[model samples]
Target: MRLLGIDYGDKYTGLAISDAKPSLAVAKDIVYGKTRQDLSKYMQEIITQEGIDVVVVGMPLGLDGQPTQQTKKTAKFVEWLRTVLSVPVEVMDERMTTGAFRAEHKGSARPQRDDAQAARILLQNYIDRHYDNHR
Candidate 1:
């Protein structure tokens, strides 16, 4: 199964992808949108072109293990995506993905690639955890 990873945000959303083998997650693109509808349509096109069977969206939960405002927003986006797309949507914890990205690019001045990197980190983590369990 091919997988797509999403780092959903209000202004910019990052995307990553996995091969049909569902092996490694690779950074794809960062999508900018004025509204959720625009982002959803753009993601749908990517899913069709990439033949994505599943989508793993990063859920930014609080360190206290509670849902934050951003988490609620991501959930809404996931729900909307499920309605419009046929692919199965999943959530993966992304509490530290941004911090991890910053650690990786410590010297950079706001790297434009950070978003995609965050997506890759979350997606790879999910793939490793879930796929390993299944195998």
Candidate 2:
């Protein structure tokens, strides 16, 4: 089953997908901003197009492991996501993911790497917890 990873942002949302093994989640594309109501529709398209069996969205926790405002926003998004998506949606801790991306990948490739790498980090964490360590 394919699992999709998401890095939610204000203007845009970064999207990634796991391979059939649910590993190696790669950033597929970005979903541009639309009206609040339209965001669900846009996400539905990605879910269908990628044949995603599940979703793993980034939860932006604070450095102290507390929920930031953005984390609350993301929680709202996840609640909304469940209605639009046919598959299950999971939230993965995304603290410092973007920061890590910026640190590792800086340059012309920065923009793409920022979101993409974050999704990878989120999905990889899920994969490790779900399968890698267990197996």
Candidate 3:
């Protein structure tokens, strides 16, 4: 099954797609969500065209394992997503993923892309830990 990863943000939402074997996840696109109109159409189009089976959203839990402001926003977005998407929406721990990505990539920057990549990492981790466990 193919999984879609989403990095929910106030201004933009980063999108990523799981590889064919579902072993790798890669950045696909960035959707502008800074405005209500943009947010509505962008996400609707993605769900329509992607044929997504599972949606994994990144949760920015702090270093101490506490939810941050963005974490709450992400959670709310996930909740709203559930009402729209027929498939299940899962929240994955995204602690340190974004920061680590920034540090690793250093000078080179693609915040939106990196955000989506972070989502992919979160989803990949969840898939490896839980989905594979059922097999």
Candidate 4:
């Protein structure tokens, strides 16, 4: 099954997709300047086009594992997605996902792509953790 991963942000949203076997996840794209309704519609299109069976959204929790304001916003976005999409939607902790990507790149000038890379890392972690169990 293919899985789609999302890093939800206020202004920009990053997207990633898993392979057909779902063993690997890669950066897909970044979406911006869309209303929530429009975004959901766009996601539905992506789901259909990419044959996504599941969606995993990154939940931005505090380092203490407590919900932060951004967590609340992410939850709302996830809820919205769940309501609109036919596939199952799940959440995974995304603490330090962006930082990890940034640290790896270090001096790279591709700040705009950080969100997509972060989503890639987040999805890769999820795949690594669950792929074995599912197999």
Positional deviation of residue 28's Cα in model 1 after best superposition, in angstroms: 0.7
Every model's TM-score: 0.89, 0.85, 0.79, 0.93
Candidate 2 per-residue lDDT over residues 1-135, each given as its tens digit: 888888988887777788887656676776676665776676678778878788889999889999989899999989988887788998988887777768776564666436767787778778777865334
lDDT comparing candidate 3 with the true structure: 0.74
In candidate 3, what are the lDDT values of residues 25-113, reduced to their tens digit?
77777766466456646656766677667888888788899888988888888888788676788888878777766877888766645
lDDT of each: 0.87, 0.79, 0.74, 0.91
Candidate 2: segments with Cα more than 4 A from true spot: 106-109, 133-135
Flag regions of model 3 displaced more than 4 Å. Answer: 34-41, 107-113, 133-135
Per-residue lDDT, model 4, residue 97, is: 95
Q: Write the per-residue lDDT of candidate 1 for residues 38-76, one digit (tens) a residue.
A: 777777898899999899999999999899999999999
Any idea what lDDT model 1 has?
Answer: 0.87
Query: Higher-TM-score candidate among 1 and 3?
Result: 1
lDDT of 2 at 119: 81
